[model samples]
Target: MAVKTNCNINGIDYYRLRVTIGKDRKGKDVIKNFYGTSKTDAENQKDGWMKNKLLGINHISIRDSLSMAMFNWVWDVLKVSGIKVTSFERYEGIYRNYVEESSLGFMILEDIQRVNVQRCYNKLHEQGKSYSQIKNLHKVINMFFKYAVIEGYLLRNPCTGIKLDVYKKEEDVGEIDLFIEDEGTVETFTDEEIPVLLEGIKNKKLKIMVKFALGTGLRQGEILALKKTDIKNMVVQVTKTLSFAKLYDDADNYSYETIVTRPKTKKSIRKVPIPTELKKDLAELNKIRIEEKLKLGELYQDNDLLFPSETGTYIDSRNLLRSWKRAFEGIDVPYKKFHALRHTFATQLIKNGAQLITVSRLLGHASIKTTEIYAHVTESTKADDVQSLNSLFK
Candidate 1:
């Protein structure tokens, strides 16, 4: 090792230290440079590097920063991990939106401490980011740091002891509100509202779509990904879901696409029994589709979807949501989200004596705990059950 004083590079003066850390596979010397404002600073960096090498944390190059390593990890590890494109985009978004330009991203990978990770999360929480958003950010960074530790780029994970629950406000503490979508509150439609809503929708296809959602409890994405072959013997097989997302390319240019992938979890892959009444409506819709396809001939871009756009390609989810909202015009009932159709299905099932476990499977929930939210028995049901006991007193 040699320390050179008063070195000038890029018009900046610094003390530079050069050292031969190791050899390559061909037995050639591997040289490294450490620069700092003073001789003590430069020597301290060199000593730290030597100590890390001795402690078996040696894979990371001194020049690697948090953003540099994170991007490489995302491409090399996550892209090929068989995750959905939407999921991959979500991870990438977290990095770009929260970490890319922050001070945390520019820090040397090996030099980051737990305090640094905590500070980043603290800043995001203080900025009024939702608990879910910050939690996701923590999850990404924590996983990345774990990868660094396993790859020998880091001696220890800085995100080990970080706690996000402590930052959650009282309003955030509650059961997952199935009634909420996109930060909007949507209540389940009552029995009376259901008929009013159906009568109000002028679009023939949108009416059928709403009926399907209520009948089967499928999510919006799952409902949209349905095909003619997915339904048989009055049962709908849910193996996949469709999502619309704005994705960024290598040049950071964004474009929208409809992505189809397997259900988010294994539980989401299920077969739901279609109601007998819904069978006729589905058949009618199929007839309409066949008629349209034949009329269009080669103009149709058929992907064999149960619901397709005007050109027969995957329907944009945003457009579907917009159309759903518009269907309530001049209707007597209050507007509820498309997701409320699913909630109505579960709530009615529980009210009508469906077992909690059965409801869980029908909703494709990963845990029965999530299904507990729908276990609320209506006052009418409770009163009716109590009225039956009056016969014994008589």
Candidate 2:
């Protein structure tokens, strides 16, 4: 016989399963026990004893407990906290791959010691993960142990003093200044290659979008958000952005959808000058829209998107990504992405000696510090400084 009960003991929650024998109305003895929660451990222990009588487990021994149940409870807590769906999914994967394989997964909560955590870190480090990755793993383990403490399964978290300082030094903290790709990093196109790329782009829209990204450093979303109304006389008001992401469940083999959202940050909301050269392209784009509207016997609405698909619908950014891949690959540039154009814009601005603050605003960076990464990526901006250093030798 077994029964279940829940109780809070000294500010910690616990479940008690117990068994006991009692006399029936017929004067026959029966046994039952259960697990339950109450205000105190004694009350919970009593409830568990009652539960044992009901379940008929006469020799029930609550010798050793499992920590797996407690770890699962912590997972539920994290899910309810609104962690990003993708991030939560990855966390679940980590639990299955790493935590479940570790011996600590089955240990009694009180038995989890610093050595247990250190062993887990050592195993992960041997698996070729970076120190940062190991550090994140530590955080997950620490959180589980803390939950154990709160659940009254353990007096204290045994992972408090686990040290991995020696492993931290093995991480390559050096500044890596290469454009990463699926395969590996490659040498990016130089400024001299820009003329060749411009010549290679045959599609007018592709050419315009590329130039816009390179000149204005607008994200694909910000560019997609542009409306005919957004383009006032000389200013391009960047109040909104168009983001393309895949929906969770779309059955029609559809892989992407466009959601009109605000820019990535409030600072990203600012006006940027429309380059004079872009005026001609904008005028042509507008003319095409007007002609399409006349063909359909409807006036072009004020809500007309600045960059629309061939059918006069809003363009899907996934299509734009595919187009970018095709366009850059066609030009024999080896590797160039939509973001690289933004990078090019920033690097070129810096090379031209634009102040960091001005460039930061142009790119809508939340902080000038983020814009500084571009300064590190491009060394051409320091050419003059190199010459200055060499001048002392002369």
lDDT of 2 by residue, 140-251 (tens): 7777667657767667777798885656653233222111111112134568778778777777777877777766778777887788788788578899877555333211
Q: Report every candidate's CA lDDT.
A: 0.76, 0.61
Q: Could you give me the TM-score of model 1 versus the true structure?
A: 0.74
Residue 147, model 2: lDDT of 67
What candidate 1 gets wrong by more than 4 Å, as runs, is 1-63, 169-187, 246-251, 376-394
Error of 1 at 317 (Å): 1.9
TM-score of each: 0.74, 0.58
lDDT of 1 by residue, 131-214 (tens): 667777888999898888787767889998888786777645333422112222325898889999999998888899999999
